[model samples]
Target chain A: MEKQDQILMKKQNKTYVLELIKNMAPISRMQISKNTKMSPTSITRIVGELQEQGFVKETKLVTSGVGRKATLLDVCGDVLFTIGVELDKAVLKIGIVNYVGGMIDLQTYVRNPLESYEETVQNINDKVKNIIEQNAIPVGKIIGLAVGLPGSIDYENGIVRVAEQLRWKDVHLVRDLSKLTSLNVVIDNELKMKIIAENTVGKAKDSKSSILVGIGSGIGSAILLNGEVHRGESNNAGEIGHTVIDPNGNVCSCGKFGCLCTYISEGAILADAKKMKDISSIDEVFVAFRDGESWALNILDRTATYIALAISNLACLYEPECIILSGNLIDKMPEMKQQIEEKCERYMWEPIKKNLHIVHSSLGSQGVVLGAAIQAQNSLFDIN
Target chain B: MEKQDQILMKKQNKTYVLELIKNMAPISRMQISKNTKMSPTSITRIVGELQEQGFVKETKLVTSGVGRKATLLDVCGDVLFTIGVELDKAVLKIGIVNYVGGMIDLQTYVRNPLESYEETVQNINDKVKNIIEQNAIPVGKIIGLAVGLPGSIDYENGIVRVAEQLRWKDVHLVRDLSKLTSLNVVIDNELKMKIIAENTVGKAKDSKSSILVGIGSGIGSAILLNGEVHRGESNNAGEIGHTVIDPNGNVCSCGKFGCLCTYISEGAILADAKKMKDISSIDEVFVAFRDGESWALNILDRTATYIALAISNLACLYEPECIILSGNLIDKMPEMKQQIEEKCERYMWEPIKKNLHIVHSSLGSQGVVLGAAIQAQNSLFDIN
Candidate 1:
């Protein structure tokens, strides 16, 4: 136990040093020791191993106030890269991400809606190799690949249990994809990944716990605490969209009636718009609402009310300091932000209202791709 | 930094040793070392500090397997006591709790509803001393006092912010009590303390995160995570009763329409029962339902359905493994347990429901008193 404790402490110190260098590079070992409050001897031992493993390197010395040169340490970011994929039915976006969660290059691939599972895997394989060749990056530099998609994903077993959007069930996502791409693979729900990105580098970076309320293809939420996404017992912790709100209302795909999503989702708004005429998409509803169409305004009013209800429920449950509203619905109807905020004030439990700050997703449509990559980097690099 | 780390580690080991001694008395040092997998030297050092502090004592030797005598340690449980008080408008229950969270002595006092706040404080001051002297316990052994009551309590400031049951606002409870007793005083909501006792020794003993859903005077909830109650930024995290379930329904006292409590709370059930006749209490409604009264049954059905809805929403958002259904509503009508369980199945979001174990509070009415004592012990003894 004594030896084990020492080893654990050493590993923790090493990770802390690595993280410090990642966040505050061009820093000297003395400064790292000062910031970490670790003894110089401990810092030397950890830094020595890091340097030998090519994870850190000595940068050019800079003269201090006393005209004394001090060596600066930097992370070798170019030595590793991760592939983050945002998958959907007809389109998938792939990004080459580095240690700092910055995407080197992003490319979108179009796929046939009727493409078989094997054909999709083969396409991804060919595209990945092409992207690597185009960037002239070594195949060895890619540590792992992570796929973010819609639906229930068994993260631990690497299986897509059910992806309603892709019309896929029981797909061995990691097993098949890792074999084709020849890299380690991880799969997770898109909203979970998006919250991970938001919690790590986006809007919720400073929050201890935060909720990312997604209003896209469907209404749902993802929770992030500390730096890890809260995946409940079955990795389906934040399935609020299916929570029955009006027992006598619309039936959901899950066979439940009056689910919150039925009243506030993009599809729900378009369905209401269809009662007047053939309104094909959410964009038309937004246009009509902007043109002072009373019908569209009523639909939005109902949607905003339910949105506030859902937000209040979430606030009561988690009491997280921040709630990020994202998804296609939020991105398109930015004006609704004020209306939703006002409704929240009405529906919110009084005592807890002042403690919360609800805001729009700062990452916008790019959160999923970046989030997928961030998860891959955190897992593969073990920098957590 | 190294010295400080060592000091911290030593204190942690000391606390761990004390806890082990409390749980496993009459055990040899060698056995403790082996069970903890800690070095013999570390165990010896920690045990020495515990003995010096008079918290632990070396007991009589016992014969070992080889016929050699082995020294054993035991915790002096009665060396310290904590005062636990459960307060309401007209009555207050006080208990002297020991190390095992056992209430050694209990006494209840009735107060004049029309009496001034100072007179009530004077009555409590006299009774506390009377109980201590009758039991012959030294005042020096009383580490601290903790009060549990209904309301939005500012725990840090030890103030009863708003207790509707007592019709009190901005009452400086700890300031008055600490002056009367000359002991440290901590005050918190009754639901918060109940969940603490439940989390530490009751139904949620083995669960990582659990919520206590209270449905007594009103509907509310308290959350426990990793042994700590998650008091939100305003110390009002689990205010689920105020969650708006219907925008078009009845307005709540908080000025919110269709609050969950307005449909499922004990007060709500009695309110509906009054329309058919003059049902003044939840107990009368329960008796009427048991007698096969259709109106009473209908009222219960609606209440159960809404209870299920609130629980489903809670399960979806928190995803905690255990949800302890409590409050006077469950206590008086135990058969409602079956009704609620069945209703939960109907409304629960499919995935999360399977992972949850909804049960009634095992500690029942004694939870608040014991929980208050535990908090006092944890805070004053610095055992946490």
Candidate 2:
């Protein structure tokens, strides 16, 4: 073999060792050798170099029968950090995460005084600056930033193509954010980020396939199949909100009549509740329903039916093991679970209904934020 | 390294070389080394063994400004064969395909006197035996059999979970078929098979994310996302038939009201056309419409509207690059394209509408057959 070829082989082996440490640590050299199909000598040499370079460290020692004890190498969790931002229709959330899936910082910003696209961008930049500064995080230690937006986004181009709730069009997000932070920027749809979050750190920790349904002001979902978030032809694979559930129902903002979102959106429920009386929030409506308010129960039942219908249709289509229900509405009203479960049993395939678990989001409203951070970390490490 | 480790390394290198040949064939050992990042000596040794094993053959040499012109190694095209069966609601079509994707034999069987599950299986087995015997095809060369059925399927366990068209439930297809044929068996939803056909041989040849919509007795769709067929949680990903287009419209067989299938199905069009007079088939309805029959045109328009609604919903959710229209009804009515495109323009996202191409299936009736064959081949080779 040529000298250059030998060097390339060594580099590839180093990458493999690094990836192994990142994924499964603190792991012993013998284990790494077995998993990577590498020689014990190679594993030892790579681990020594990584430890010296501050990328890895010996965390513990383990004894083996009839042999010498071995040291376990672990990736240095503090080597780098990632910042995640979720830009929703009515809220903006930020989170800082470490390499080992630990949350370092979290903050929320309400978008009640909604601004224009440029103004929102400026506000986000300002908040990010203040957070980083107050936390005393070094720019060099921040590996990258990931932003999750509510709408169709071009991941490759880093552009938010169209977000109906945000009323934004063709927003060049990555470029704008990169200029301000001087860090690698990545962006994707909020639902896609939610799937990533669940897969990486939340309920779908070991699940090969799962569905994350976000129900708040509008309904949306993210599909994870074969351990990866599915991004369809135009990066709009999980727009479940647009799926038609009521053919002759109310018209959606997308100009379609009777979309799933039109029936189950927070605004839809509030609008229906307004027909009876004034209700400030979904939480208030749920409280009223608990007190035997006929109008509130009726509205909740209708909303729950629509939610169930959408989930049943999804279950028949994807048959995921679990559907993680997130978003503000779910956080406010947990009693809707029974209604959704009952309707799901009535509508979905029997076998699927038997196995399905309609669980609330572990991350709650902060799901998108944590998901965004995980997304950023994934980009930095190239980990699935 | 130990002898056992060395042997394992050699096996890994051999598998890597085989994958390289499958992806980039008609190339030299030097090219394989470059593509796979394997040692040149490893590539040469694996290529030599592969040639001796009859898996690869040397092709014509290519001129280069090097020490010697290298002979190209290519996969043997006729090393194996597979059987594909399309189990439709009305008829069953079968074909034999070679390793190089060439069809060697084709046959169609109409189900005039449809039998029970046991009887149908026995009949299919008899037909396959006769065809194999008549053609003198070697059983050793036949790798497997794949069947496409129009309904939900559990691809993992090879179970026909629930096929409404065939009235099948919990059928252990692989187990039943393996009893009759020694070869391996694979079964999947018919629409998924069509998408496989398009991805492998038809209009969606270059599209990584594409949709195939079958408009016939009932509506169904197959989605291909991220260069892989998107089989949702339980191998039931593309159930476009049940998407509600009218919440208050006619009740569907699935007990849903105003499903897309209710409005666009051949039965729906025929039922609507019956109001004007006697109509035998969708082909006759299209003929009458082409001859300036106002009632036929109206039926076509309504069907197109429902189909457009479904397509628009799909576009918003999946954003496929192209949508292939196929099935008995679409084959007979080509003029429905213009009306669907026009309606889609108003319903789909503006950017998607600008780039979307709605067209007829290139393989037509042969698509399901070819798709089944491709599915068999995919299983035999473990192709994604």
> How far out, in Å, is residue B195 in model 1?
1.5
Strongest candidate by DockQ: 1
lDDT of 1 by residue, A1-384 (tens): 699898787788889999998888889888899999999888888889899877899988663777567899899877688888888766777888877777788889877868888888888888888878888888887899888898778999999887776889999989999998889998899999898888878998967888999987678899876656877767787888877667778887777778897887777888889998687978999999999999989989889889988998888777888899998888989888999999998778777788899998988777888898888887777632
> Which candidate number has the best TM-score?
1
Tens digits of per-residue lDDT, candidate 2, A30-139, equal 98999999999988898888778778998766735768788778898777788999887778888888877777889998885468877887788888888888888877
Per-residue CA lDDT of model 1 for B175-224, tens digit only, reads 99999989889899988988888977899886788889888767888987
The lowest-lDDT stretch of 10 consecutive residues in candidate 2 chain A is A346-355
TM-scores for the candidates: 0.90, 0.83
**Which pairs clash in the backbone of model 1?**
none
lDDT of 1 at A61: 65
Q: Give me the displacement of residue A331 in model 1, in angstroms.
A: 0.8
What are the Cα lDDT values of the candidates? Answer: 0.83, 0.80
